[model samples]
Target: MSAWEQFITYVSQNGFYIWTEFYRHFLMAAYGVLFASIISIPIGILIARYGKLSGFVMTLGSIIQTIPVLGFMAITMVVMGLGTTTVVVTVFFYSLLPIIQNTYVGIIGVDRTIKEAAYASGMTQFQLLLKVELPLAVSVIMAGIRTALVVGIGVVAIGTFVGAGGLGAIIVRGTNATDGTAIILAGAVPTALMAIVADLIMGKIERMLNPVSN
Candidate 1:
């Protein structure tokens, strides 16, 4: 086939995969972030609230990071068996460190003077947290979340190795078929698009939710 005809043929054949799996991969990445956030945010808040726990939290997250992804997945599969649960949980755990670290840093980085002023103004602890501390810390927390999301997107794409299908299925197919460009585009394009869109959306949300200071 001529190059133009080959291009047309590839587009016709593969466009469905792109459209169908793009959001699937996006959701997989999102699932990783959501599950990780559920576990990490509360713990990070507690760690920041108590100096004693900060060391413990950091140590644990760091230790988890040291474990290789393939090893962790194999262990999880052996213990829990195959399928979505194992893949999701593995991706979730992989995503936790960034969220927890970022949250702790963000909360701790709040200006002490602002905190004091809020307290002196008769604002309750809850109010101070809601109106002052969280708003200021949002940027940092979002940065952490952004990092976790990017990492999770990359990792979860490999979950096809465990029977969970996403865009990774396309990648695996291309690899086995020896179609180099197909695998690269199939995997890289959707992932890159997801990361860009997610970061942009989160950036807007952070700006909107965070209070502006003069």
Candidate 2:
């Protein structure tokens, strides 16, 4: 039979297993991005408010981003050991740069005239940030999140190497077996779909957050 036929047969027999792996994969990426956002958005706000820290913080994120994924994972393994924790931590670290950088840029990029008006109205620093800056920067921040989410989805596949249990496990298993192309497809196709779906969803959110007057 053909590879396609084999794939069909495999899925027919192993649908439950594939679904479980896909769920785990989705969770890995979702939790990672979620945690990163919680941490990074506030840091971004701080960086924007204190211009002196912007360069140092951005540089730190860039340095982390430059680390090879495998090398970072290896280092994390030493500290975190193998499993979901390591995978989640790795994904979280990878997701940080874009989110934080975009948030900082978006906030600082707000028109100076608008900022002055807010200041002239006696808005406190917290008030200006919450009412003026964050609202205006929502679209940019969402764009960063969308990018990070898609990237995290792809990265989560690497989790299988450390026994974190995602679709990557399927890919790894397939590579280890004879006539495993079908098995690899079982994992690969779903991962691609996940990324596409996440991108589309995030695109809608980004558009929704953008000011209609703009």
Tens-digit lDDT track for model 1 on 80-118?
687666677787888888999988988888989998999
RMSD of each: 2.5, 1.2
lDDT of each: 0.78, 0.93
**Candidate of highest lDDT:** 2
Candidate 2 clashing pairs, residues 3+ apart or interchain: none
After aligning candidate 2 to the native by TM-score, how far in Å is the CA of 144 from where it should be? 0.9
| lDDT of candidate model 2 versus the reference | 0.93
Candidate 1 least-lDDT 10 residues: 2-11
- Give model 1's TM-score versus the native structure: 0.87
